[model samples]
Target: MASLLYRLGRLSFRRRRYFALLWVVLLGACAFAAVNAPEAEDEGFTVPGTESQRAFDLLDERFPGGNSEGADARIVFAAPDGRKVTAGDTRAAVERVVDEVGAGSQVREALSPFEDDAVSEDGSTAYSTVTYDAPGEKLTEDTKKALMDAVEDGRDAGMTVEVGGSAVDAGPEFGGVTELIGIGVAALVLFLTFRALVAAGLPLVTALVGLGAGICAIMALGLPTTTITLALMLGLAVGIDYALFIVSRYRAERAEGHPAEEAVGRAVGTAGSAVVFAGATVVIALAGLSVAGVPMLTEMGLAAAGTVVIGVLVALTLLPALLGFFPQAVLPRAHRAARQPTAAAKEAAGANETTGAKETTGAKETTGAKEAAGSRWARFVIRRPLASLLLSVVGLGVVAVPALDLQLSLPGDEAQPTSTTQRRAYDALADGFGPGFNGPLTVAIDAKKADDPKAAVAQATKTLKATDGVVDVSPPLFNKAGDTAMVSAVPSTGPSATATKNLVKTLRAEADRVEADAGASMLVTSQTAMNIDVSNKVTAALVPYLAVVVGLAVLLLMIVFRSVLVPLKAALGFLLSVAAAFGVIVAVFQWGWLADLLGVAQTGPVMSMMPIFLIGVVFGLAMDYEVFLVTRIREAYVHGERPAQAVVTGFRHSARVVVAAAVIMIAVFAGFIGMTDSMIKMMGLGLAAAVFFDAFIVRMTLVPAVLALLGRTAWWLPRWLGKVLPDVDVEGEKLTRRLGADPGPPARTTPREESVNA
Candidate 1:
């Protein structure tokens, strides 16, 4: 890597513009390719007999001709006063909504109380039982704009019309807003950090290249995937991350008097390896979500992994090409006075460590230049390892106190953009109708083989009405082919609360009891049932996912560092971070701290599987920066430095880079909270906080201090085990240092390094 850096440096001195042009050509080609990218239609949500063949099979077997017991969307008409809206004004509004409902362009169908006897009796408000023609078809930008305009037009009409249903409430605008926030935040962070337009542009460029290439690749990869709101942000983040490491390295090389090309090569050789590993870590972490037992989550994992793969390749190739192209931009501005080393500078570089304040790196020549000037961090971590760890533990513990209060509700159109017609109708429904104004659980009792599905449904209806909060139940919506009857179960509370949980419990248990007494098999299934099953699936898979993540992290660390103790300590440290994140999630979301600040409905219960999900992802991210830091420390240790020296010194050099990268990510994540959807908001805040606290407080502070306390023991291994493991070059430093020391080589000097006549 060092040799590569030096050679590239030489090339930068010779062919700076050529390198720049090469990158320009390549970047243009990549972008052009992306613009012409083909679309891939993957299985997301499938309609019974549309393009998704599998969906048809499932529908035919499980829910043919619509499962009456399945969930349905509700649309309502309302007055502004928040009461039973039944004026001529409300009637006109209701008619307008109905007009849209039967349009077929907006959805599969919207069946309201006027259309279905199951909706409501003596209703001032109507329900729109909607189904979409294409569940996975993204609303195009123009369509979303038109929806927004139509809603404004309705308001102008002064009829007080609001339209919402299952498939209409949550539309594409929410997704777009979320993406915009992420991009804006990331852009702001990079601009602030870089301070120059070019420098700022560089990271964004890398992000665009990586994301564009990844999108095209995903389209071409023959995977069952479609574009999502989160896709662009995820791609940009990973891309910027990859670029940051290389750019930081380039800057470090410029400090060493190496040219841009050399820095690129060196950066690729060292930071490139770390980027690959970091990308892999992310892949591993997200892969755990594949086992979330939802086809959506499984698809998410695959798409996320595929994006990372594309990012890694573009980052490796295009970045180096860009570096070769823009030597002047890559290097810092030069000045005549700044050209010479100070008289005392040479003395500082050659000095050895002595009885001093604290030791960082044993490589005095390299280490002294990199330390954080006046770092209070070192004093705190080194002097009080246990205390630092405890502070992080307690702080995060307090934050997670809300995890016990977390809740997971199925994302719906009501969570969509407030500006859209669908979302407006949903709001209208909720205002005039009730909490289940959008979509309520429909419990179907399977009496398909029974002589009397009507009696069984009546029994199920009685059981549902007996439940404390169930507002009403349908008598029976009998299927022609099967002796099955569907019954609606509406609750007073929203779908992601303790009330929802209680409702599910009551419906299943009471209906089962009624069926047993009636000598019938009652299958209670609905939207609520699907949600219940999904939550249960997440719960079931949590343990295995966590085990895989932790075990793999430890093993990877062990291989990378060649010491069990080092990896063991690293794993424990990461575990601490995960626990801390969990505790905070519980405390804030479950317990409801500043939920208003977070913009959630309320803390429900930690999402049934949030802990497991957060653990895998945050652990891998924590470990990535950890490796980026510790591997350098290991390099110092391998070169005869003490473990304490390695930890402190390595941290001193890498801390700023890692922190800068982390700050950018935090910004990107935190911005997500600004989105309208409550679920996305929760996820945004939770992940943002986890990364911020973990990266800065836990990984940066607790990790270094603890390792310092352990001293040489942190790197200890049995002699026999050590003998079996071959030494791998951490930075190719041995050969570089040897070349520096060898008397056989000619003495090195450059035009910039020549001594004056004085």
Candidate 2:
């Protein structure tokens, strides 16, 4: 591996045009792929569990559920004070508002206190319900505003009004604000780190290609588009980032007077290994998410894994190819005199030593980066591996303590960003009536003669009382003279999922007892109950799902690295990083540390699916750094250097590039915390934790520290294992040796002993 990086690096110095032409070809292919990317079906999303979804066509007719599709919007009318109202003017004014809102005829059911039979029993405050029958399962803005304006017009008529419901009610306006922040921060860091207009833009170009491909692919696979769309953006960011680090390193070699071919080869040999490792790490980390047992979460895991794999490939191949197309004008002038960076230049190569390594004609030792980076990282970790590791351990421990406190929330359109009228209506009702008003659990009973007169309503009443969440159990009342029984169980407050689960537990238990006692079967189903069942089903399937993914990822890495331990060790590193990241999220967000500072209003437990998503995403991303760093070390080792020397040398060479890459990622992820969207903010915060830990703690300190500690065993493979395993030179060491002039072993750094006198 070491000889290959050295040789290809030398070859790049020897052959420039060949490499440039090759790059042009790859870019053209990716662009063609991008151009051919097909449009998705209706924004290209499919609802999950569609094949096995409960067949409720019968229920629709049976219950006619009188508009039970859930509320479309809620209109709130309040007086300035909280005092109960007996005023006729307040009522009249509210009626006028409701009339105006309902006048558009776009909605099916517009209910309000001002409307007949719709006023609150106390008449202290009022509300309006806006129902709709839309093609895409949501009311249009035209209808939403009519409802909103009715309330607004009432404000002038001595009533204060608010509108909230539907998608608008699901989340806050700043819901995706964190995403914007993360992307912005990432872009800024990319710009600063690369210090070249084209270089900075390179990731964007390849990422867009990969991302467009990912989107098209997933859409073609037929998955629903929801909050999970956030994954796409994140995937693109990481893909671009991974490519930027490698190509920039390669470009630096070119600027240093090496032919583009050798530079490309070296880039692939050292940074290429890193890319492979990062890809493996990502695959392992995300594969775990597949095991989380929730189909929704598993789907997300698959999507993320696919994106990383495909993205990395593009970064490695397409990005290098695109960079080869740059005109000679893009290369910096010879470094005899200082040169100011233009935006274009800055986007390609930051004025850092990462670019300067090329000045040695892509040679190592005197010019080798791994040794320098390794030494610097060793200085930090050797002195304080314990302290740094401990801080990560302790902080993560503190934060993850709340993971035990995590509870799942119900999913809804209202869970999306709330810029729509339905969301506004939902908020109005949640705020005006009660937070629980947004969602509640329903209990449905199935008996022998569901709607017949012979059904025993009294027995069902007794059955419901013993139910755990029998908060306000109602006596069974039959639609057709005591045949079918159904009751509604409204949770006192909060997301409906948990409350539904509890109610299902209580109902199922009582139903079992009744059946055993009376020899009659009954059915109990609720939104919450179904959701709980889904959770259980997902959990049951999580382990096997994870095993398949992890196994595959490990197999791929092992094949690439030709060492079982490398794959296994990388998996372990990814785990710690993810664990630490999760712990921080729990400590800060769930535990409510500086919630105001972060603008996280809800301190309730994170969504049930969040942990798996975060862990997978973080693990995959951190592996990116791991891959680059380890590859350099391995390359040095294959050069016949002793393992100890390899560790030190490899660390020096790979350290700075890894650090710079991580910093850019950290900035991008962290910057998104300030976005207006809550979910986007969560993503930013989680990624920020992952990136910070990967850079300062994992890649810089822990990884090098461990490799130094591991000696040759880090890449050990048994003779028998070697016989069975196919040798894969992800960098083609044999091919490199045969093809190029040797750059020679990197010159050893001047010792501190000799430096003082020099």
Candidate 3:
């Protein structure tokens, strides 16, 4: 790996201009393709074999007129004074909206609620159903613009107008503001860490180039999945992080007195190798999402995994090329001045130098200046490993406590901020009708087997109405063929409410009972039921999915570290960090702790898909710090030092770079909270917390303690296993050996003659 990286660095440096032009042309092409690519569709989460899916299939089969496979929306109208929508003026306004919206070429039909007594009892609100020819998510940009414009026109007529439903809410928006904020924060962190403008800007430039290309690639592929937002988010964060890691290591190597080209090679050979492994771990974790067997998730995982791969490749190749052009300028002015001696200082140093006295004094000063703080931290933790371990555990436990009560559900409009028109429409419908009116359950009754179709319909209605949670059951609407009919049943609770989910299960169970006696088959489905199915599937798959990812991570770590205990410790720390992050999500988004301060409008269950995505993403991300820190410690251990001393020395070398990388990652992820989408916000906060805790608490404190406590056993491996496991030299130890450089503690003191000659 070291030799390969060295060659790569030399090639990149020699062919820097060619590489630069190549990347520019490639990114330009990607941008062009992305501009021409079709907009992504929101393929709602689906488990094909589930009961809700079965019902949906039956409906689409038995009744073709309803456009059951397409999108449905509701245009809600309300008066300012809570006056009845049935009043003359209000009714006229509603009629005009229906007419304008229904006349659009995109709409298949618009059904007025006034004709069907769908208005509220107080007459304060009414809504019309607008069915589009295509699935709402697949609607063209022009069609959406037309629909929104029509809906907006209603406000001019003195009516409160808002549109709700999956279709209306699925329109895509940008996180440009959030992305800019994240970039700014990341820039600040890089500048402070490097204290060099050129050094700080390099990582950001590389990251942006990779991100821009990756996003365009995703768009160009036009994968029949909803992964644009996820791809962009992952691409941006990982791109920045990968570049930061490599660049920081490169700068450190330069400070160690290696020439520009040699520094780049050593940095790429060591830290760049670590970046590849870290990026692969993340990609593997995301790709593991395909095991859940959901098409949407599978595609999303692939899309994100591909973007991460791009980020890694760019960091490895293009960054090296870019760095070669301005190696001298990469270091800060102060750093450069420090490396070169002034004439007066050189003369004074020569006069003071005698025997080896000056050499020994300089070594001590170097150690004191460079190793004081990190060494102190390492020694402090090592001296009281038990106490350190206990404190770290206690801190993580406090943050994880809220996870015990974590509730998972799809984020409905009720959880959305009130600033959105979708939320306003959702609120109006719930107020005028009932909470369940927004997500009514559709019961598809197959009556061909029953002795009497009418008898089956009547029996099913009676059974549903008798169910404890049923709020209202609509009369049966039979298909023209008379072989099937559908019934709409609203639950007593809101769509995302726990009670509503339970109601779905209860009704499905009762339908089985009804079918047994009445010789009929009933399949219940709706947006709410489908959401419950997705949640249930994810819940069932969580433990197994985690087991797969953790096992893979452990195997990879063991190969790299060649230690049983090290991998186990890393995996455990990862779990603790993820749990703490989830706890934060539960407390803020679920328990409403300081939610208002964050601009969250309503507190509810965490998004159903959050845990699955978070576990995969955060676990992979946490490993990044582990790889950086542990590799350095292992490098020291291999070079000859007591286990305890090695831990301190290695940590002192790597802590700064690891922490800076984590801060950059956290900033990029947390920036997503500024997005309009609630799901994105939850994801941002969860990921930021994961990186924060993993870097500060786990890697900084707990890992050192555990390594200290284990002593020599921390590096132990069976002879057979050692021979079987390939050596993953992530720290360029071989290169140091080949170059005949002192890989151990910095030479205690220079030879007397060498010191005097200086």
Best by TM-score: 3
lDDT of each: 0.58, 0.57, 0.79
**Cα-based lDDT at residue 463, candidate 2:** 63
Candidate 1 lDDT, tens digit per residue, 1-758? 34444444345434545655664665567557655656555443422222122323433465665632222344444444453334566555555655554563535555544446523333444554555454424544443344344445445555454544333334332245655667776777665544445555677787776676666555555444433334554676677877777766655544444444444555666666667667777778877776665566666566766677667766666666655544445333331134442433322221211101223335452334533531336545777888877786777666555444456655555445566656566566665557663456766566655567677667667777888887766666666654655566677776655677676776666655776765455544444455555666677777788778667767666656777777777677666666666666656656766766666554445554455556666776777777777776776677677666566556655666677778777777676777776555656676777788778877788777667777877777778876776544444465446544752323233333343101
Name the better of 1 and 3 by lDDT: 3
By TM-score, how accurate is candidate 2? 0.78
Backbone Cα, N, C clashes tallied per candidate: 42, 81, 2
Ranking by lDDT: 3, 1, 2
lDDT of each residue in 1-758, candidate 2, tens digit only: 43444454344333435654554565466556645656322331212342112323323444666426543665677665754434766767766776676676555666756433434455555676666654223556676556556666877776657665552343223225555665666667666655556666777777767676666566556654552355464566677677776766676655444454556656666566557666666767665664654555666667767777777767656655554554232344422112333343432332353434321223334433432444555656655545755565565456456566555543543443455444454565555555554555454454554333334445666666655545445455444423445565544454444564565566666766655554444555444445455555554554665567556667766766677777776667666666677666666666778777886755544554565567567656766666666666676677676665565555655566676677667765676677655566677788887778666766666665566566677788888988887776764466556545655444222233123213
Off by over 4 Å in 3: 36-44, 68-71, 79-82, 135-159, 334-372, 741-758
Candidate 1 matches the true fold with a TM-score of 0.79
Order candidates by TM-score, high to low.
3, 1, 2
* TM-score of each model, in listed order: 0.79, 0.78, 0.91
Candidate 3 lDDT, 108-195, residue by residue in tens: 8888889967788788888888888788767777767777887878888788889987567655544768768887998998887767
Of 1 and 3, the candidate ranking higher by TM-score: 3
Of candidate 3, the 10-residue stretch with the lowest lDDT total is 353-362
